[model samples]
Target: MANTPAIGYKFDDISEINTSKDAWAVVATPIRLWVVPSFSGKKLPYSMELVLMDAKGGKIHASVRQSLIYKFQPLMNEGRVYQISSFGVEESRGDFRTTGHGYKINFQFSTSVRLVKDLPINRSPYSFMPLSDVALNNPDSYYLIDVMGILTGYSEELEFEKDGKKNKKMTIEIEQDGVRMECAFFGNYVAEVLGQIAAGDKNNAVIVIQLAKIKPFRGKISLQNAYGSTRILFNPDVEGANSLRQRFLEAHEPAAQVLNHLPNSGKISVSDDFLKRHWGKTVEQIKNMRANLKPSQSFSIPLEHNRTIEHNKQNALLATGSWGMRAWILESEVCLRPPW
Candidate 1:
């Protein structure tokens, strides 16, 4: 698959299956999506395509793969290509009822659109160097940060589809500003950030965004660390131009307040006796100590899987750029290595 020609699409990744002519006998799973573009503060969802494309760029007969009703769902409002939602792996056999006949990969849905600029940038703005005497705790403000993190835990338990597809509905835990917060990914819309962020990495950039208060649930006593329990769709112009990094760094420049002042937002001190410190304190206590660094300082690696980001990056650059599905276990995972 390394030699597979790159296709032009928004997924930024792709995975091809190893199949043969025998695949035609198995049922092709179909997916239906509702597309909605917000206009005037209201959202309207509509149905779109039923596509059947072969690996060689030919259209497969939808009826032969599944019932007429199941094979004819819309492609999408944005006209993205469709893939098997859950298909059988039976070889030259039409046995929907047989075990070992097939398996499933979670169907993925995505839409790539440019931000209208005026469209609100969600989340908190910069802190630290860009700080002021004013404490703006509004829930709807956006922030500028270059730091990239990963989803460590989800509030809701995850569920898989019939054919072993991964359907996860959970809040992400992003380690930002030396703290972790609850983030979220919706339905099939979770954009895979495989190569972008790692577990304990911190990269800074300049920015001007906002910070706001939020409550994950009702009756909650204290506020949450999340700007919102929302998966923010970053503006491509900013993401592509590295403006997000720029904005994040701008916030950390020396100023009225440094991030290190706060216990949770401060830099971590590393020492050969790091484990000795843990003996006398609770995890939270030691964590708070680490967080209480001066704004000018940084933190230590908190997770052993820190290599997650770099590992995914090679996988990301190797696949085709399509927004629909990000293939993780594809053979091409080994193709794209960074130049020394």
Candidate 2:
């Protein structure tokens, strides 16, 4: 039971605790383990043990206290995700002969926040972060190889595990004229590149790389950016583009909260005249704050002047000019989506 504390969890921080630990030591232990997540709570006072993957820094387990159920007894269906905040624990006292040895923990659930999804960002595996932050109007029709700069140098490297239990990961860094970003040619790709580097300097081994949605940091450009690049697909890696798109969708899929927080107020029967008067003011304020021009920031504007104003997520309620383009304020710039 004393060793149950070290079950399977590793503590992130242990600088705050004052405790003496010895190998095969029989000592008093803390029995409570706490977890913060949106729990459906079908299993109350559940029988669970923490596994200590590391003897150096193991995580604490504070037994959960049904503070909510004890107070109001609301019906919480099992299988729902919950987010929790703070918690605590309890230890065993009594001696060996009379009461025997045992310790129990006490945990508390603080606030309940819903989970959200990621945003929609598309890109490639080889192009994980390969896009350079450049503007191209007719991007889709061109070859990305003609896009980015040349390759400069590359080096073989190793990726190490924290515990030193696993083998060092074999890696290579392909340096382009931009930033020396990495492209992994795993499995068979590793063997092929190994021979090329070993044979001589593969200095002339130049490949055309397409750049998109590149976030700038200093002057050194990095290859293959995922977000904002919009997954510009060129030749040789068209298959990779599809995979990149999937990842983008997965990463940026809106968190439930982000979507729910979107302004669902305003009216439906919005006309141009109504939009002209109201949209100008609202759009003006949004511009001042420098909100990213997203579907959420869109307002209807008529060809003649500012017309009727109706706030909504999207529909005819939001399109720009005849191009059906919607203004998006990203980071802090007003970017038009489906720009024509």
Candidate 3:
């Protein structure tokens, strides 16, 4: 008997696929995967979201929704190539689109997934965005972005009560070539980063975060971990980390030298000219006015009353400066520069 050769389904490039068809044949590498729990908090009703990259470096978003989620969840593994068919295609929606593709996949009851055991393509595509251009592309206000930078500074852990639960948070500031960005991590991430810093990891300066959400807080843009699917790498095996670290080292200065330039005194200066112009009086005249200020003389002893009035007068003199400037003076006691 003559042997018959089996025919494989024709696969379509992810970039070229759209919502025009009800079914598609897609063969792609799973670069990122996120499993979201159902709304009711049931285990069986969960869904999977993934970003798949094609051979030509094209990337698209695919998802396993509802009833068919359980069947395909176990089969799809990140960093593997699979030829999927009979899945529903629809227009990608929402403010946060993981991929730029106009269409995304929806796993149906008849969806078929077959993993390719033989490995040939090894590298996955990564579209890392620079910190400067983050504001331009992040206009939609909720897209997932990938960023890599050198760690410049971090803040102490903060504990806050939200919804009757105590949550821990930490903010890490990173810089790329001079541009700075801050990202806050909650819960386990706080511990994870603190541990890495404590261990004195050499690669602590180089950080790469994938599937991070862009958030604008108090007039500043912040990068935040998107939880489940998000991955954080310190000194990853990729060349990008090494390249950035080298650039940082070449331009880096000694820690003490950098710290010396920081402003240690009050930023606001009350000049003699400003006092004369605004208050119609000179600095010496103001000093005399404060010295002469007195409190109500009562049954209290004269010395005790004099002390109380002196204390109140000093407070009033301090109050002349703005609240923020007052706090700065108290902390560093940095003398204000005399504006001649």
Candidate 4:
């Protein structure tokens, strides 16, 4: 049972409360948390933002001003449920309201938070949008989406400028049920991903992001963090993460086994044109090229010719022990490279 409420306090659903009121009890889970620092990069009274979901399947944005953060920070834990009361309510602003609710919670120093024990935490309150349904052609600019998938790969962090402002972003590739897509994380999310990779905690993990905005690039849809409203959970202790991990492992096992026997399986940098030319071409296509070959030339002659211009690149990558031409060698009848 939850802690007994104060005498005058009464429970209220987050969906029902709109105006500035007092003494309403609300039991909700804190799904997301963010600390906003002052503009000068100083710690001058940082404010906090939270996305909370209640038992009745209602979600709303919540805020704790800088003055009260110190008093409430210790009591607030993301993913934990609490019975709270005596908080202010204000009409949620458009840019800040991630949920559809008309109002948001405003916590004060006098607000009370009593942790609710013995109940299973409900981490996911919204239905997730599949990668297949999201597309660049979709007209909904403000649509928020959730995604759960396996982290297949990632690119190096890129810094670029737009509108006379510099920003950092990274592209993350995620796959679900044979569908692969890219998502971009900006600012703090970028730092979080880099930190996890640095700590080696991202080796075999599923990433789940909530409330991401879908933006299109080059005719493809890309998910981006929705700033204050988005929540990211990496390898969370939830059933969805476990299921994704299992599926990812099962799907990659065959490739993993092949890599285990092949020491130099790392990819060498190649242009998109190169991959688009060779990656999906059947062995028959290369075999057909045999007729165009000179009588004395080996079947690998064309491949070697393609490599001639990239000789320095090949040598550089090979010297660093990261290039693997063996896969191509094994799959092809080309006699140019020695059998590994």
Best by TM-score: 3
How many Å off is the CA of 97 in candidate 3?
A: 1.7
lDDT of 1 by residue, 222-268 (tens): 12222121123222233322643443345445451222211122111
Clash pairs detected, candidate 4: none
Higher-ranked by TM-score: 1 or 3? 3
lDDT on C-alpha atoms for all candidate structures: 0.26, 0.30, 0.62, 0.63
lDDT of 4 by residue, 139-254 (tens): 34344677887777777777766445677777676777677777777776778876775665665567787888765433556676776567767777755778777777877764
Error of 4 at 21 (Å): 6.7
- Candidates ranked by TM-score, best first? 3, 4, 1, 2
TM-score, candidate number 4: 0.61
144-221, model 3: which lDDT tens digit per residue? 788888777777777776556677777677777767777777777888877776675633367788877776543456
CA error at residue 280 for candidate 3, angstroms: 38
Cα miss at 303, model 1 (Å)?
Answer: 43
lDDT of 3 at 207: 77
> TM-score, each model?
0.22, 0.20, 0.68, 0.61
RMSD of each: 23.2, 24.1, 18.2, 18.4
